[model samples]
Target: MQRVYISDTNIWIDFGQAGLLDALFELPFTFVSTDIVVDELNNPAPAGLLERGLVVETLAEEAVEQLFTLMAEHGNSSLADVSCYLIAKMQGLPLLTGDGRLRKQAAKDGVQVHGALWLLDQLVAHDIVTKAHAAAALQTMLDAGARLPPVDCAHRLAAWRT
Candidate 1:
């Protein structure tokens, strides 16, 4: 079975801006998102992602209440962010988020979290994208103002260039 991963809003924006949305969907995993996260994404992105097989999950009422509770505890996280975290936690799925606050909160809750760089690595490791292609995607993300870790980005860029 393909692994399922829950993605928040920022990761979508990062890949969309990087023009790597097509490449992202090429990866061998089932990508899911909360309804809130899908609603949060701007035009073309939501449609494009859905067409690429992005699953939009509607949370249960109890889960929605938990989302609000989580929001109260982690004030820095948006509703959409908390929604992704909650779903990931409940389903034992890894979370894809580039938000620092969300990452910290997810860590506190024992939810595994990853970002764009990890996704890029996955693409290369799965042979869905070439090393050079992954490098270019990373560069494009950087050029599009993605707030990825510079050192990690540099390390991957250097290694993937080989």
Candidate 2:
């Protein structure tokens, strides 16, 4: 079965808006989050729906050690980001994240990264929602304080329509 690793913040927010967490309940995949990600979510900031209960937050001790070593060897970013990337690397799973910087860094490290736009496309492709619905959901996310890039949002909508 496919395994999906999520970063600290981005996917949680997007999934919260798009009801993606509910959809995941039906998929044959395991969801994982790192300790660092757990810390990020436990911040004073409000937690999204995805972060509220959907993710499994447990990391092997060796995995945590490996993550720290990787962060030290490579350029370090946020502990959460590094942990997410390291977990994906160790497990050979694709990371689900919407942070551009993290996505680029994951790619440079040869890790697979899937962002919100990709999730939108998958929702469209799977007929989980209509193109119009997805577009409206994107707008809803924007109105809810999500800072999605205009071009990326437009492209995702256009792709859905196609």
Candidate 3:
């Protein structure tokens, strides 16, 4: 995993709701979010995430112009995703997103992307979360309404306990 990541709202919610956001802090990397994305986190949790070392940042001044340019080009682009993309692009960091559209758009724009399942895998791999715990967290995320890992990752999530 990269030493720094710009996280999308969905992935943040998954970890936050699953009680696994702290696991991210155990990793060498730092997680960052734009103020805009933090607002979209819906309250309280963003404060907690920040308290737990998640870096909430504002877009660079130049990024405002760049963001406007991108929005002008891709009228349908999500502002949330664009904020994340801009921060990651400007900082040369990878983005963490569970949104497929955001992932695809980031790829098209040459920005690197990852998702929740990868974070779970890392947790298990690094012993931050045991496989059984990681499996349970996955189930928790699903139950809490995180529609991630593309349904295709069900098998991996299922096999975590074995």
TM per candidate? 0.92, 0.72, 0.86
Give the CA lDDT, 0 to 100, for residue 139 in model 1.
Answer: 93
Order candidates by lDDT, high to low: 1, 3, 2
Which segments of candidate 2 are over 4 A away from where they belong?
A: 1-7, 42-57, 62-77, 158-162
Q: Please say which candidate is ahead in lDDT: 2 or 3.
A: 3
Candidate lDDT scores, in order, read 0.89, 0.66, 0.80
Which RMSD values do the candidates have, in order? 1.5, 3.9, 2.4
**TM-score leader:** 1
lDDT of 3 by residue, 1-162 (tens): 458899878877788778887887898788888888888877337788888888888876787668777766656556676788788877888999877766787888788888888888888888998988888888888898887754656787668868
Range of the 10 consecutive residues with the lowest summed lDDT in candidate 3: 72-81
Error of 3 at 139 (Å): 1.0
In model 3, state the lDDT of residue 121.
Answer: 83
lDDT of 2 by residue, 40-117 (tens): 764223344345444655677877777666666555356677777777777777888766666777788788888766
**True-vs-predicted CA distance for residue 39, candidate 2, Å:** 4.6
lDDT of 1 by residue, 58-134 (tens): 99998998888889888778899889988899898999998888899888889899999999998889888899988
Better of 1 and 3 by lDDT: 1
